[model samples]
Target: MRRVWTSYAFRRILQSVFVIWLVSTITFLLMHFMPGDPIEIMAGRLNSAGMSHDQALATAANIVNYDPDASVWAQYLDFLKGLVTLDMGNSLTSPSKTVFDHVMEYLPWTLFAVGAGIVLATVIGLSIGMAAAYRRGSAFDHAMTSIGSFLTGVPNYILIAAVVVIGYTVLGILPFLDMRGRVTAGVEPGFDPVFFGDALYHAILPIIAFAFTATGSFLLNMKAATTEVLTEDYVTVARARGLKPGRISRSYVGRNAMLPVIPQVALQMGTLVGGSIVIEQILDYPGVGQMLMSAISDRDYPVVQAAVIILATSVVIASLIVDLVLVKIDPRIKTEGQDA
Candidate 1:
């Protein structure tokens, strides 16, 4: 067992290194080739105040605290070196905060929302799916399938937009989810209850949007898995053996049916925090997704590269967890001598 785990960890570590490198390279390239100059983003107010474009550009360079005259290759090397120090340099938008500091402030809140949404979606989706499969052609099955299909067809951003308008305009009750918080003018936040409450209040709409969009896919997948499992030979045998329906249902059907979804579930959950940028921004949730968006808009190379590396790390870790879970749930994984 120790040998198996050790081998698995070693393999995952190697994969992680490759993923980080790939992500870093991609992020660097994207930021490098992105449309619009960082100077424009940095000197927006100056431009509005009638600064010439050339003047604006130079000012932007000063604000970025880097010599834009440097070769792209040299800038990239510095960005990569910053990764080693966990120094994401400065954000053109925030101006004052390093990319690392900015992301760190917002990541936890997004993680909290994504974590809750995943747990809720999986539990609800699987339960509904199994019940529907058990009832195959019943009214409940049709109802759920119809709803799932309806939700799955719509783009997630639309749902987020709707949630924002409805929650704020129609309901007129929930507090706005401002990126960061709704602090008194100029007051710094220390994650106190006030800031936390403001964050939570705003999280509601984004969470709902994410959950709604994500639930449909999980339900559809689970339903298909359940249907297939129900028709399996083991399930047939269990029924023939006169095992109690619930036992046969859980052990014979649900267990095996859940196997195929294990990988997808892990991947989706891992991505939830980083992937819901549209929803996060629409609802103004202070999360990693929004941070990535800001980094992209500002052409903050160090920040973008660091965010990509973090996301890649998360994905690799999730994939590793999925593999281990697969081994545990299905001993027939045949990993014997090929432990890793």
Candidate 2:
């Protein structure tokens, strides 16, 4: 066990778990210490619906599965217990639904959009960046650099807004109303092509918005990395040995240049996931961000807490996976025990 502490993968897993626990705990504390009581707030709503104060209070407690009279520490323990059991209780506002149900319903769409966008951005960016690096001082290189700088400087929301305005308002080409949700009104989700196509159609705009800014960062980083790799002795030796340009670029340059940029993919994914809130709202898309916004508005504590924890956990896990991948791909990246 003591030896395990020095293992890099073990340390990363432990750190990820600790970070998630800390986030969930802080979210729990914030919810409890916030100005309003969730049970009281629910009770007030029930009272407005003609229930007597005492009846409303009792009903609210039962519905929320929370005892207002319990000590804060007791409640905190219960919260942690619920987490362990994967039971976040029922949603406060929509008492019929569990928080997990709500999160699961919407979380996948957000993940899809972010995942698809990052992948698209990384591929296109790396290719263009590599080409630009190879053609260092030419017009294409300068043009790409300027475009990348502009994209990096612009906020994703601004890009989203521009997309909406141009695609919907000016061009009159985009069917904004039809593209609002995850699928067409009557489409049942399944393995069918129609369902998949429609889902991608609705997701396209948000994906574009996410990919738009991320591409620039990837491009710039890949360009810089490729340029640096070009200066290395191995690359010069490969050229001196009369290797084909394509072989030298692919086997020697591209592979090495990608190392730095690969880690950025995880970081970019985290950023895009967080930014999904604004993008989803603007597009009126049904995803975790939209659900979180609605939960916060309705003071639905369980849903809010669950949504936050899920998002945080996704990011932490992405980062951990990237770190582990880096170790696997790059021999120079020494794990703690490897040093000995």
Clashing pairs in 2: none
Per candidate, the number of residue pairs that clash is 1, 0
Cα lDDT computed for each candidate against the true fold: 0.72, 0.91
lDDT of 2 by residue, 1-340 (tens): 8777777789789889999999999999988888788788889999999999999999888878788889999999999998888788888888788778878999999999999999899899999999999999999999999999988999988988998899899999989988999999899999999999999999999999999889999999999999999999999999999999999999999989999998998899889999989999999999999999999999888889999999999999999999898888786775444676
Cα displacement (angstroms), candidate 2, residue 335, comes to 3.8
How displaced is residue 222 in candidate 2, in Å?
0.3
Off by over 4 Å in 1: 1-9, 32-78, 93-96, 166-199, 334-340
lDDT of 1 at 102: 75
Candidate 1 lDDT over 203-270, as tens digits, reads: 66666666775678778888999999888888888888889998997788888888887777776766
**How much is the lDDT of residue 25 in candidate 1?**
78
